[model samples]
Target chain A: MIKLEIKLMKNILGANDEIAALNRKLFAERGVVVMNLMGSPGSGKTTLLEKTLVRLVDKIKIAVIEGDLFTAKDAERIERAGVEVIQINTAGGCHLDAAMIQKACTSLDLNAIDLLIVENVGNLVCPAEFDIGENFKAVVLSITEGDDKPLKYPLIFKESEVTLLNKIDLLPFTNFDLRSAREDLITLHPTIKIFETSCTGGTGLEDWCTWLLQKVAR
Target chain B: MHEATLAENILNIALEAAKQNQAAKIFKIGLTLGEMAGVEVEALTLSFDVLKKNTPADGAELAIKRVPISAVCNKCGKIFQLESYNFFCPACDGILILQSGRELLVDFVDCE
Candidate 1:
């Protein structure tokens, strides 16, 4: 009896999927390309956005919805980067859900923005469960975080459309097995686009930027 | 930590399903939480108890199924269960790509 009950407990995700579909439709109508940037804390997600803002802010009107457990620091940084930014302080929340993101969207001028980047609260697990009305999910993995990360957190790697292996500049200092990580990631998600980047040194930004531009344009 | 929110989502889904089926009472709410889901089962149960009070699903039992983390190794082509935080195959130190078991879903419902 217990085994049967457990086996039937598989449809809960369908509920979340329904909500996500509705969100996807709403975003499409507005021509807003939403990217959910997910990563462990200190994976250089904000830094990448900051650097992008310096280069692309003039051409593409970008807005960010920063999800953090505490503090308005990230939002402030983006604001200074010359883009419309809103911060959703989840307090102790681990992930940013669609409901919370929908509320955040109200504060932005959606009509003027081409891209809406949601920097999800630094988590690889919980964030993958919730869809924050995004076109695609992006995962940032620092080389310092270990190459074994892709295998340990395969869901994030599989769910994400693009994986940014950030902090490559630190590879020389650390024993991060980049080849193994890429191989692991590719095995799980055959089509996932992997970008090697260092947000601090600005290496491999051009490829990432090009990918973002083409994706958003579509 | 976020188990409370997940419990809320479960209740929301149960309530919606109850409404959809026009069932007077929800007998059971089922869930499949994967091993790698990062959700604490104890936290979910505690949150469910608190949130279920006064709702139609108050007495409705929550059935949570735990799935083992199983992956297929790219190098060895062998299926094996993962141990601890290790996500690599023990046979050949190959990438253990998740094949199944990480099922965060509500498969069915028992209503009357």
Candidate 2:
């Protein structure tokens, strides 16, 4: 028996990254801005999408792709808000990969849409690992989830280009520290855009929508 | 939780490589996992062991090399190892930019 040694240096995520690049090119050619919205299970992502769509649908055409573990509950909610929505059930998977998004895009009219918002699976750890061919990644971290979350799950915050500090209306009731969270997040990503939002009162929705519109225009 | 997917990818890549090299059997697979790659070693190993059966890489040993997270200070230019996710520079209080962590790669394959 002869011992054979093979030397190969390869990236494990090379396939996923390749598909993501293709998706990026397609989105660019279609002139549609895509955003990957991620957060915890109860991070108010659905509510945030509702608020955003209600505000921006009249200004620009928008569509959505909703990802979940089992059901179309979130997609149903987005549909009620008045827009074209596609649902992807991961069937017990933890995250949405680039290939999934590429397949889902086939059913939609990319020419008619100005923006495409993909609501990733509700996972702080796993979702951060996969790139779903988004122009930008935004993470929603509600105030009630504890301020230590930024330091604990640094990858999600670090990977995101924007952060929605949601549930600001409940800040008075919770012990969440706004200062430390900001500091930690800034330390991790110095140029990250931060927005404080409250879907219930529509407190910071205008600023968030405005920022998103600006990104789309550029 | 996604380690299963990663393990499957690893095995698929190794098998493809072994077949390309005209090898009959795979004896070992080597991996390089970094501190900030967000992969759990034990779970990855378990998934690889389970998925690698009934193939050329059956009973293959997973040799993983763990790498520590390190960064270079922008202001002071001192390289330092980071732990517990604190990225503040110890020398000049400047934010330390990442230098070496966040790697997830298949290094090599051993077969005959």
Candidate 3:
């Protein structure tokens, strides 16, 4: 057998990207806006979703696709908020891929939904790399995670269009430098919209919901 | 992080390429990974080794070239290598837009 080199410059993430594009097309065709909510574990993504749904459900139709490593706990919480939700258990997978999101999208009624929030598996690194065909990628970083996180996980900060500085109510108890975090995040992504949020204290839910409403309206 | 999944995709792509070339065995696979690709080289290599077994692309060596992270200044448009992981322009102090840091691809395959 003769050794031969076949030049094939194919992207490794092509399959996932293709599927994500399909999802994006589907959402656009149905006049639905999708946001891929990403963050580290315990970044208060679920709580924020619950609070956002509570504020905006009466205004527009919203649904959720909850992603977790195991258990349907988050889906249950979203269900309690009176929103149609589907849980995707990756078992031990680090992040949710476009194929998984596409499968989850099947369970939802696309025509009835104005907005679809895909709560990605709570991971900072891997989740940032995969696009789930959402209109925007929003990341939540708690004050407790420290200000250096934007530098440590540049991809998440850079990829996201919005940053929810969650757990702001606990700012006084922790050494998290809110200013430095904001500066670093802005440096990484100059156009990124930021919000200081406290789910427990209900600090910035109103503004955040208002922003979401605007996106759905657009 | 998702290097294992990436390894699988690489293997499958290599297998397909080998078949297209009408080669019975894959010898080496050329992969290009960026610094900001969020993939560990060691982990991806290990995963590829484990998955290549019992496949048409068995015992294939992955020749991976890691591309360094770089960005272009949004204001001045000066491109520079991001050695310190800082996303700011040194010349104009402008916000640097990422140029080519986040890429993972199968460049080519050598087969027989």
Q: Which candidate comes out best when scored by TM-score?
A: 3
Winner of 1 and 3 under lDDT: 3
* Interface Cα root-mean-square deviation for all models: 6.8, 1.5, 1.4
CA RMSD of each candidate after superposition: 5.2, 1.7, 1.4
Which structure among the candidates has the greatest DockQ?
A: 3
Estimate, for each residue in A129-216, the C-alpha lDDT of model 3 and write its tens digit: 8888899999999888888998899888888999999999999999988888888888778889999999889999999999989998
B-chain TM-score for every candidate: 0.88, 0.95, 0.95
Per-residue accuracy of model 1 over A21-126 as CA lDDT, tens digit each: 7778878888899999999999999999898778788778789999999999999999999888899999889988877877787777787889989999998778
Arrange candidates by TM-score, highest first: which order? Answer: 3, 2, 1
Best by lDDT: 2
The residue pairs that clash in candidate 1, if any, are A9-B31, A9-B107, A10-B105, A10-B106, A10-B107, A11-B106, A11-B107, A12-B105, A12-B106
lDDT of 2 by residue, A1-218 (tens): 57788888888888998999999999999999999999999999999999999999899999999999999999999999889999999999999999999999999999999999999999899888887789999999999999999888988998899999999999999999999999989887777899999999888999999999999999
TM-score for the A-chain in each candidate structure: 0.93, 0.98, 0.98
Can you write out model 1's per-residue Cα lDDT over B1-112, one digit (the tens) per residue? 6688778878887777777766666678878888877677889889988998898777878777788878888888999886653455678867677776667777666776
Q: Any runs in candidate 2 off by more than 4 Å, and if so which?
A: B73-79, B87-95
**Share of native C-alpha contacts between chains A and B (below 8 angstroms) recovered by candidate 3:** 0.83
Judged by TM-score relative to the true structure, which candidate is superior, 1 or 2? 2
